[model samples]
Target: MTAGVLDEAIKKAAIAWISVGDGPAYALWCMPAESSILVVSGPGEQFAPGLAEAERATVRLRGDHGGLILVVDATVSRLTPGSDEWNELAPPLATKRLNASGTADELAARWAETGCAIVRLTPAAGSAVGAPDLPAESAAQPPRETPARVETRRPFRLHRVRKR
Candidate 1:
């Protein structure tokens, strides 16, 4: 990806309309620290079985013209700001944005309150792994940001996923 594209991706936390080749393809991605999710959309003929490993999962399309694959690697930590010791781990620009208008301690505290961590991903020079150019007409827009407001509410009823 170009520097411009990478900057956009990092700023938006997602990319769309990337072009890999002369095949119909598009991807939507979300990266929150150690976890990143990607959804690939393309014709079936372009699909291929993705590589699977101990820390990775690849789901491939299962029909004619279904050549698309969704490859997710658990080992690659998604880059996150204000978490996972980002000040020391992330690139300088990422650190600055994450810690913007706040002290390092303050940012760290915020991340802790949100139950988040930071992880780094390699092949990171560009924003994404593949370069599939998408047209503006087919791209997805980012969600609108909601203003923060304080509200009073009762505590949640207790539900346990596992008993100690």
Candidate 2:
């Protein structure tokens, strides 16, 4: 069933491309929950622009081969800090975060104090499209501009080669 595929894809995905209406998709780290995904955005976390204000967004999951595997429409809800839902999800999410500087509880506290938004994405019914239904287009885009670039220079030689 489509729901089964959606659930499995969400479970396996560590990152999902989330986009609000007509906006650029931002790849965000997420943790799968019961029929939903929890994503942290804002200060000291991944920048997910417009997610906190948007009521809905599209979530794209990729396969192991790095191809698009599933797409679904999701309802976005920003969880309130210190709520029961936040209490349940934050510590686990913090634990899953790689290279974190502190304990899970400490990270969770920081997230709350530093204005991070934890958005929950719950799939809308009948919105999942599995691989078979995916569009033919690859949807690739040019990489975003950044100040960083590789420096170019002449290659170093150990010694001059003799001409023959």
Candidate 3:
């Protein structure tokens, strides 16, 4: 039952919240492939720090209605460029990538040159949880500090000038 639910959720989800060991979770765009989920990260792509080095990570997926649906532990594996698995998954992933700057082949070449990582996240056996087991809290946090900020400005007021 858990495996079925997990698979379905992973299949339908375009994004998942992935947390590396002792780190805050980050929302990453992903694609489901067979029994595993594939994510591309590094330069010019979504940021998933320590994912390539980490052996395991937590994956939290939300339902269509915007509620946390499933949580699972996944074993992380990095796919080598030009390998069979990379060749098979890269095209599909590249096609699905939004706002990509180049063609699939170009992107793949760039990724290889820049050391981008294509990671596979396979759910650990019997580690899926859902529904009643999910946390009660909303888990929202304050936005991270950034250099960008709104500039203060005076409000404009319309005025009628008297005839000279």
Candidate 4:
């Protein structure tokens, strides 16, 4: 595994897409620190239910053309707010966002209040997998085309037919 390169990619990418089991991929806002990816799920962020309880998860930092840039098979764990682990990690994630909070401390407190869960995805060894390219998913479920409507209006004569 290219640990150095993967870690650097993680640090550079502000968000990574993650999926668990056969579930759909979710756009997760993340911060990479200490060889792990930090993500928070709550009221406003992308919803990732059952992630904390899941044993293993997949984190992908994608590149152009739907290609997988860095794929990490990670172990998922939950960090309860106010713990030492939470203290060290959650604040940095909060700070990464523009409107999170004025300070990390305040955001941490908010996380506690809202029952948000901080998920830590630690990449497994030999899991810095890369893919050349992936076909687009638009074919599987194509978007529905909507019909255009023309405006309806009353037709008028130039001179109202000389007032009839």
My TM-score estimates for the predictions, one after another, are 0.27, 0.90, 0.89, 0.73
**Alpha-carbon local distance difference test for all models:** 0.34, 0.91, 0.89, 0.75
Q: What residue runs in model 2 are displaced by over 4 Å at the alpha carbon? A: 154-164
Residues 1-164 of candidate 1: C-alpha lDDT, one tens digit per residue: 35443333333443322222232333333232323323222232112122111132321111123222122223333334544445544333233432145665554445445534333332233223323432224233565344665566978868856868
Cα lDDT tens digits, model 2, 84-160, are 99999999999999999989999999999999999999999998888778899878889887678666899899999
- The residue ranges of model 1 lying beyond 4 angstroms of the native Cα positions read 1-75, 78-87, 90-95, 98-101, 124-137, 141-164
| lDDT tens digits by residue: candidate 4, 3-112 | 77677777676678888987766778888787788888877665886786888998878554454577778899999877898888877778886675469778777877
Task: Please report the TM-score between candidate 3 and the true structure.
Answer: 0.89
For residues 45-131, what per-residue lDDT tens digits would candidate 3 score against the true structure? 898999988999999999989889898999999999999988888888988898888898788788888999999999999898898
Give the Cα-based TM-score of candidate 2 against the true structure: 0.90
| lDDT score for residue 29 of model 4 | 80
Q: Give the better candidate number (1 or 3) by lDDT.
A: 3
lDDT of 1: 0.34
Residue 93, model 3: Cα distance from true site in angstroms = 0.6
Scored against the true structure, residue 12 in model 2 reaches a CA lDDT of 89
